[model samples]
Target chain A: DVKVTQSSRYLVKRTGEKVFLECVQDMDHENMFWYRQDPGLGLRLIYFSYDVKMKEKGDIPEGYSVSREKKERFSLILESASTNQTSMYLCASVGSTDEQYFGPGTRLTVT
Target chain B: EDKVVQSPLSLVVHEGDTVTLNCSYEVTNFRSLLWYKQEKKAPTFLFMLTSSGIEKKSGRLSSILDKKELFSILNITATQTGDSAIYLCAHCNYNQGGKLIFGQGTELSVKP
Candidate 1:
């Protein structure tokens, strides 16, 4: 079985505070992705990493950044948390089977 | 930009009813189309369609792709309360740098 775990299931942050979201995959997948899901807008990609130390921006990556220093770890960083940045964040990893396993998700609230 | 659209945005049905969720896409250099089921938190993979006309089935759930029509449909038969969830459709392009453009998704409600 494939397992993906996120750092937090819920987070509360004050405005202008920096936030960090962590994800770890146990399947040693080569591709990892971060997405934020909002009602009516569905899920939008934030960032993705195909390999260690390499990252690519997704559709809505303006307020977010990512780091992948190891094969199984990916981190999403918010430079400064804003009210608009509050949303449910999801992390996923894909392997040779072309299937992506997703983490439970982190619901962040900016106050 | 690659675009994916799914409709009707939401649906309600009773137990034992069959439902078909639709997805259409306009993608450049299409690699594959994927379907996922989101119950509570993260979405889980359901089907990955590459070839047209061939249907992928897993017990009560099935899906088929149409390359010519640029569309796909996921059918769930004999749905139960447990089958109620949001169905998402996404398209993978060849040059998007591993990006998957997703549809807004169809929220399904199955009543017992």
Candidate 2:
């Protein structure tokens, strides 16, 4: 079974504070993705990395960045947490068969 | 621009009711379509459709794709409270670098 784990299930941060969200996949998939889900907007892509030291911007990459130093781990960084950044963050890794498996998700709240 | 669109952004139904969710795409180099169910946290994979006119079924859930029409539909029968969730639709393209373009999703609420 493919297992994807997130660094935290919930996080609270003050405004202007930096936040790091980590994701680790045990399946050794090469492609990892970060997405932020809102109430009505659904899931909007934040960033994705296809390989170590390589990254691509997604639809909503503003105020967010990602790092992939290792194949199994991907990290999403929020430069400065804002109230609008309070949302559920999801990480996903693509399988060999083109199927994408997701982690449990991190709910971040910026106060 | 490649896009995936889903109808009925929100739906509320009583127990034992049947529901159908729609997804349409105008994606360039479309490879496959996928459906996922999200209750509170992560979205769980439900189905992936590649061919036209082939129906994939699992328990009370089933889905079919139509390549000719560039659309797909997921059907749920005898829905219970457990069936309530946000159903997401996404399309994968050949040149997207493994990124899946997703729709806004349909929020289904099943009342007991």
Candidate 3:
């Protein structure tokens, strides 16, 4: 089975602080994604990396950035955390298709 | 623009009952549709449908996709309390390198 693991299950940060969320996949998938899920908004993509050092902005990439220095690890960075940035963040990995394997989300609370 | 829509935002059903979840999409360079079951934390893969009229089944859950209509349906038979979860539908296109466009999801509640 494909195992996607997130660094933190829950996190709380003060406003104006910087935050990092990490994800690692054992499947060595070529594609990694970061998304924030809200009540009515569903899962909106923040950023995605297709290969090491290659990143693309998704629909809602503002206030968020991602890093893929290695094939197994992907990190999401918040330049300056704000209250509005609080949401459940999910990380996923896929090979050639959309059949992604997801990690347990990190519930971020920016106070 | 590519979009995925799911209907009946929420549903309540009793154990042993049957439920159907709907998903529709309008996307360029359509590739495949995926179904996921999310409990409180993580979303788990359920099914992946690529061809129209082909049904994918696992236990009591089954799903079928209609590419021509740009829609899909997920059916749960003999539903149990454990079956309650948020069912999510996502459409993927290679044009975006498998970036998934997701629907709002259907919140299902099964009472025992």
Candidate 4:
């Protein structure tokens, strides 16, 4: 089984603070993604990395960035946390056309 | 732009009842359609449908995709309280790095 692990299950940050969400996958999948899920909005992609040091912006990338320094780890960075940035963040990994395996998710709350 | 839509937004059924969830999509360079079951945390893989008219099944859950009609249906028989979850449908496009375009999802609640 593929296992995806997120660094934190829940987090709370003050406004204007910097936040980091980490993810690691044991499957060594070539593609990793970060998504924010909201009620009525579904899961919207924030950023994705196809290979080490290669990143692409997804539909909603503003105020968010990602890092893929290694094949097994991906990190999402919040430049300046705000109330609007509070959301359920999910990390996923996939190899080829197979289904994506997702981490347990991190529920971030910005105050 | 690629898009996936699912309906009805939510449903409630009693145990032992059967329920059907619907998903429709409009995408370029379509590759495959996938189903996922999400509880409170992560979404778990359910089925992946690449061909039309063929049904994929696991236990009481089954799904079929119709490429020509650009839609799919997921059916659950003998529903149990454990079957209550958000069912998500995603369309994959290889040209888009196999990026999955997901529907809003159908929330199913089974009462015992």
TM-score of each: 0.97, 0.97, 0.98, 0.98
Candidate 4: Cα lDDT at A106: 99
Q: Which window of ten consecutive residues has the lowest lDDT sum in model 4 chain B? A: B92-101
Candidate 4 local Cα displacement, residue B36, angstroms? 0.2
Name the candidate, 3 or 4, with the larger DockQ value: 3
Q: Residues A54-95, candidate 1: write the lDDT tens digits.
A: 998888899999999999999999999999999999999987
Looking at candidate 1, what is the lDDT of residue A99?
Answer: 65
Per-residue CA lDDT of model 4 for B16-91, tens digit only, reads 9999999999998889999999999899999999999999999999999999999999999999999999999998
Candidate 2 lDDT tens digits, A12-108: 9999999999999999799999999988787888999989999999999999988899999999999999999999999999976667899999999
Between prediction 2 and prediction 4, the one with superior lDDT is 4
Candidate 2 DockQ category?
medium
B13-64: candidate 1 lDDT, tens digit per residue: 9999999999999989988899999998789889999999999999999999
State the TM-score for model 2.
0.97
Top DockQ model: 3
Give stretches of model 4 more than 4 Å off: none
For model 2 the interface RMSD, in Å, equals 1.0
Question: Model 4: clashing residue pairs?
Answer: none
**Runs in model 1 with CA error above 4 Å?**
B96-98
